[model samples]
Target: MNWDRIEGNWKQMTGSVKEQWGDLTDDEIQQAEGNREKLAGKIQERYGIEKDEAERQIDAFAAKH
Candidate 1:
């Protein structure tokens, strides 16, 4: 799936994001608001992972969706 589709459907996607990154709070995901960079940042903060790893995880998630 394209990032554009993900962004366009952000509200619907939140549940999947929560399932994938359980550490992230709903508030954090809402704050991200479909921005890839912001979502990556939240994932990094919640998972204690590096930026690259966060982005990689996001890529995998996007691909799955």
Candidate 2:
């Protein structure tokens, strides 16, 4: 989904997001503010993944129902 849709639904989606990125604290997700770029950055920072991989993982997750 696009950033607008993601941001709109962030409150509900954050729970799933937190589950996906177990290492990220709630505060970090809050700081991301539903921006996909920030979320990808945080995922890479917290998980030590490459930027491309982090984006891919997030895109994949976002595709899920």
Candidate 3:
């Protein structure tokens, strides 16, 4: 989904985000606020992955749910 849709439906989407990035807390997801860069950045930081890889994982997670 697009960033706007994700932001608008954050309450519903956060669970999926958390499920995908299990290291992320509810507070971290809340801090993300559906910003693509923030989520990807956090994933990269937590998982020690490249930015592109982090984005791909997030996109896959979003697609799954």
Better of 2 and 3 by TM-score: 2
- Report residue 54 deviation for candidate 3 (angstroms): 0.4
The runs of at least 3 residues in candidate 2 whose Cα sits more than 4 Å from the true structure, single-residue gaps closed, are none
Q: The CA-based lDDT of model 1 is what?
A: 0.95
Scored against the true structure, residue 54 in model 1 reaches a CA lDDT of: 94
Q: Against the correct fold, how does model 1 do in TM-score?
A: 0.97
Summarize candidate 1's per-residue lDDT along 1-65 as a digit string, tens digits. 99999999999999999999998999999999999999999988888999999999999999999
Best by lDDT: 1
For each predicted model, how many residue pairs clash, with residues at least 3 apart or on different chains? 0, 0, 0
Worst 10 residues of 3 by lDDT: 56-65
lDDT of each: 0.95, 0.88, 0.82
What is candidate 2's lDDT per residue for 1-65, written digit by digit as tens?
A: 76578788988789988988889999999999889999999999999999999999888888872
**Rank ordering of all candidates by lDDT, starting from the highest:** 1, 2, 3
Question: Residue-wise lDDT of candidate 3 within 1-65, one digit each (tens)?
Answer: 66678778988988778778899878878888888889888888888999989988877776665
| TM-score to native of every candidate shown | 0.97, 0.90, 0.84
Report the alpha-carbon TM-score of model 2 versus the true structure. 0.90
Question: Which regions of candidate 3 are displaced past 4 Å?
Answer: none
